[model samples]
Every structure is written in structure tokens, then in C-alpha cells.
Target: MLELRGLGKRYTVHDREVVALADVDLVLKPGSFTVVVGRSGCGKSTLLRLLAGLTLPTTGAIHHNGGRPKVGCVFQEPRLMPWLTVAGNVGFGLVGKVTKAEIEARVEAALALVGLSDFRNAYPDQLSGGMASRVGLARALVLEPELLLLDEPFAALDAFTRRGLQGELTDIWLARRPTVVFVTHDVEEAVLLADEVLHMDGGRIIGRREVPLPRPRDATDREFVALRRAILDDLSGRAGSSPPPA
Candidate 1:
């Protein structure tokens, strides 16, 4: 569904050039959920922005097959309008394209999908942090996006809230099945949410690991333990942390 060939990005600030990404190549298949995991300043978010066309690569190309795919992005914050109600925020993206009736229907459906149907009329300030984040997700889902780009969308929530939203997100993905490229610094969250994990470092992809474990994954399982260790080693810049499962 998405392809990046020789992808690279660089910025010039005050006459000094900084490379954010370099010679990176990746392919994303239709409906696949892939997570890019790396420490801060590792270019993970830059990659997502490139895919989202929010920024252009300095030295490479991103190609989507045939027709341009619809995209929805969820940033670290809810980014909802302070004055807009929940339904208003979710339907905000549909303006000019969809009819008022269609927009209302989409907003209501997305709200229900994210377990926020009861709070449809609540304002952003009235909602808790987690509830506000769900509003962000609902706004994205209302677009019926073919590709969903999430940049640590749950990083700010409390642990329990994060976990709850993670499960909710998984169920939503399983049902809607959008092509997802999620970027996160949390290894466990990436492992639990993605079908494949890509470890990035120094503006390049260092490793690709497939998570074979079943959904509703057990965090305490032995296999999960091994995988976690391997990912930790990779992020820590260890050499050949562990061989890929044979």
C-alpha cells in the first residue's frame, strides 16, 4: 500500500544541515499494522510525516499504489478545538467533502467505535485526558482513512487508560482494518499493537522483528519476555541482540 525508496530527509537551520533520515527503504502492505520503535531523535516521527506528505524527503520517493489513499493522523495530543463538542470535533475533518447528514452519521459511528458515544456532546475541556485522546481517535476514524498514522497517540495517558485505549484501538483496527504505521518509543506498546516491529537508530532501520504471539498477548509469557529483551538490546545499540526466530 505504501513504499519508500531511498528515503531521506535533511533540514537546514541557520546554515547548518542536519540529516533526520538517511537512505531508508521500507514497504508496507495493505491492511498491515507496522510500528516503528526507537528513541527520541531517531527519525521515527520524521518517517511518519514523510509518509503522510506533511514533509517531503530530500533525497527519495514515497509512492502509493494507483489512486491516492485517504489518510488520517493522530498526533500526541487530541488537538481538538476547545470550544467544539465531541461530535463537532469528530466531524471536523468531514467539512466541505461530506454532507451534513453524512458527517453527523460518521461522527456518531466513530464516537461509538471509540467507546465515547455517551460523551458525544462533551467539550474537550470537560473530558479527562484519556477521553480527549479517544476523541482524537474518533476524529481520525470518522474519515474512514485507508492509512492511519499514529505518533505516540497514547503516550500521555495514565497506564490503565493507555492499556484500555490500546485494547480499544486493537478492536477498532481489527474491525476497520486500515493500513497503520504507528510510531512509539515504548517497546511493549509497539510489540502488543503491531504485527511487525521496526527498530530504528541514527536515521536508519536497524532491525525488523515479527511478533508471532497471539492477540490479547500475555505480557508475562516466556516468549514475550525473550522478545522484549531482544528489543531492549536493539534499542540500546547492542550488536546482534538475538538472532531472529528460526
Candidate 2:
């Protein structure tokens, strides 16, 4: 489990203090998939960065409940190395510390998990947008991380590709059961992917909505629509009513 208490981050822009996150208190369970949704600059990405240890908080602390856990992070872009092939990028993290056999095995397993086995030798420039994003996912999964943080990884793709990748991501999460915090601004995407959806605004968490719906959710379903409506309402500052609890 991971816990955040009074977590805050602030940065100075031209000597002017700008607050990014403010007093966030959250608890993330092992194998739980939580998605944070908010407008850009609402501090969604900042929270993920704090969790991934890419940045230090100006206040409060992140508790791992014990020792530090292995963390993997994928940003909005694929960010693959231009010179590395699919397999090479996937195994980048394991290159020096692990042996050849171990790296190959882990890399192969990750590619299989992401359904990119056929593209092992393909370079980044050769991959389509959707395929490149999958390679990014494979790179993260290769570490077999205890915690995975993804920030709008599929936001750029077309609708068809986005939905397909969303399904694949859900499958990966279900199979590996990694503690995941995926950040996105898309309400429907959040509804489709998360076990629990968190709403953030102005650098603070506003509400929490749990999606108890079963796998392979249908957006056209009444329940799913209601859930999305509740999130939209909350985001708009009119949370007087919400979808009935699942």
C-alpha cells in the first residue's frame, strides 16, 4: 500500500511561487487501479510524478508502508529511444544489472503481454502511433514493477486506437495486478479504465467515485452513463447528485 499525507508541491517561476499540488491525502492499495481526472495543470501529473519519485514534494511525505517499491512511469509521450528497437527499448531498464537470459526473458514476456512480439526488431520510426504507445507500455511492464504510473499515454491516438489500447491496458492490469495510478483528462476514458476514479481541481482532490462495474464495461449502459455523468457533474462543481452506489 502507498499513502500520501498533506502532500504538496510548489515551484518558483521567475521567483514567483506557484503551487502545483495542495495538501493531498490519498491511500492506494496494492493491485488497485486508480485514475485521476482533471483539466490540464490541475496537478494530476504532479501527483503522479511525486508517486514515481521523479520530483520531490515541498511538504508532507509519501509512505510505501515499508521499503521503497520498484516504480515504472510512462508519460504522455511514448518517449522511446530513437535508436533502440522495440525489444531494446523494452529491455532498456534491465540492460546492465541483469544477465542476457534474464533480460531476454523479461523483454519477451513484456512484448507478449502487450501483444507486440512481432515488432521486437521494429524501430521507433517504423512503428505506427498506436504500436509505439504499446511499445512504451511494454517497456514499463518489462520491469514487472510493483507500482505503475501512466499520464495520458493514449490521449493522442484516434478514437478507435484509443479504445483498443484502453482495453489492452485493462487486460494488462488485471493479469499483473500492479498498483496503478493512471492520470487522464478524459472522463469517459477514466470511467472505462479505473476501479476508482479521483477528481482533482485547482491542485486539490475534490471527490472519489468507485466503479464497481464488472470487466468489459459498456459506455452505452445506463449505469456507466450515470457514472460518467457524476464525474462530469463533480468536475463542473455541481455535485449535488451522483450516480447511486454500485
TM accuracy, model 1: 0.96
RMSD (CA, angstroms), candidate 1: 1.4
lDDT of each: 0.91, 0.92
User: Candidate 1 overall Cα lDDT vs. reference?
Assistant: 0.91
| Total backbone collisions for each predicted model | 0, 0
- Regions of model 1 farther than 4 Å from truth: 243-246
User: Candidate 2 overall Cα lDDT vs. reference?
Assistant: 0.92
Worst 10 residues of 2 by lDDT: 237-246
TM-score of each model, paired residue for residue: 0.96, 0.96
Instruction: Tell me the lDDT of model 2 at 8.
Output: 99
Writing each residue's lDDT as its tens digit, candidate 2 over 1-246 gives 899999999999999999999999998999999999998999999999998898999999999966788998887999999999999999999999899999999999999988889999999999999999999998898888899999999999999999999999999899889999999999999999999999898899878899988989999989999989888988888858664343
Candidate 1, backbone clash total: 0
lDDT of 1 by residue, 1-246 (tens): 788899999999899998899999888998999999998999999999988889989998988888668999999998999889999999999999989999989888899888889999889999999999999998998999999999999999999999999999999999989999999999999888889999888899978899888998877889998888889988887897776443
Best by lDDT: 2
